[model samples]
Target: MRGRDEESGEFFSPSRSQNRRDALEVLALGEKLVALTEAQLAKLPIPDSLLPHIRDCRRITAHIAHKRQLAYLAKQMRREDDDVLDAIRDALDEDGEAARREVAAMHRVEAWRERLLADGDAALAQLLDEYPTADRQHLRALVRGAVDERNKNKPPRQFRELYRELRELIVGGSAGTDEEDADNVED
Candidate 1:
């Protein structure tokens, strides 16, 4: 003999019963609505004031039907991987102008990136050569300083003092003076 829990009671089968009841009610209501004339349906309290809602429902139904037809056509056109590849190749061959334009656009982007890399690399290499003894931290600080200086000389706000401060911190370990400073000063 099987035992059921007292708390759960009846095995939670409300969904099946509720779904069937709801579907039957919907079918009956739909038949009733269909039998009513437009004027007769308009007399209904909610429908009388919400003509736009009724129109929107009709539009949604038509859109759903159109989408279903499109989906059926797409499903019917499904093919093997090789067949799809062949079809794509045939389509591309038929559109030679479009293929050429795509290739040209790709080449242009490649050329632009190559130019940017060349310019950036040249600038980075020059900065590295200038600070040959400097470590990675020093190099980053130097680049940051230069960018700050360039930004200050341009527009709304001044940045020369900020650049000088960062430059001093980079050369002289954030504490005070650098090793080279002591060597340069005569006793």
Candidate 2:
């Protein structure tokens, strides 16, 4: 039949081709999801039940089996809330943005470490004011060790450690110390 019926003056429902195209779009989204690493996929707003199907699809090697798995994924997606589709789309789009922000954060930490090493007490004071919870004594020791290593032409172990400590302080370390330890700190 034609797209519209003249007798009723009402538009026909979605055509079969339109329905197929929509299903294909969803399948394509499923394929994109399968391409993602498990950690990336975990960030998606999909149901927990669908995760095993997706992981199974990732493990499948044969073309026919993979195709069937993708079809299953599509079926599962259809049953999930509509918001899951939008969430997947948004997460994929934000991947680049997230990467850029991570790089910027790394650069900022590196700059702070370098400034602390070069500018000495002034930089330390500024950093302490910024990260009030940071251990001032530890930072002073690292700076001293790094300088001594530089003078003696020894391995830059302390320099590396300083970088690591700065990174922890700046990025919010999981096991970071919170004590001010001000009385024990030395100049």
* TM-scores, all models, native as reference: 0.22, 0.64
Residues 1-187, model 2: lDDT tens digits? 6478789877688878987897898899899989999788776676788889889999998999999999999998888777777666666765655455556556666777777778888889988986788999999999889888988999999999998898788766422332232211222
Q: What shift in Å separates residue 112 of candidate 2 from its native position after superposition?
A: 1.0
Cα deviation in Å at residue 28, candidate 2? Answer: 3.6
**Model 2, TM vs. native:** 0.64
Question: What are the RMSDs of all candidates, in order?
Answer: 24.8, 7.8
Regions of candidate 1 where Cα sits further than 4 Å from its true position: 1-5, 11-13, 47-53, 56-187
lDDT of 1 by residue, 11-124 (tens): 544566776665454344333433445675554432232344334343454667744533333233232243542433333353654465444443433332233234444544
Poorest stretch of ten by lDDT in candidate 1: 178-187
lDDT of each: 0.41, 0.78
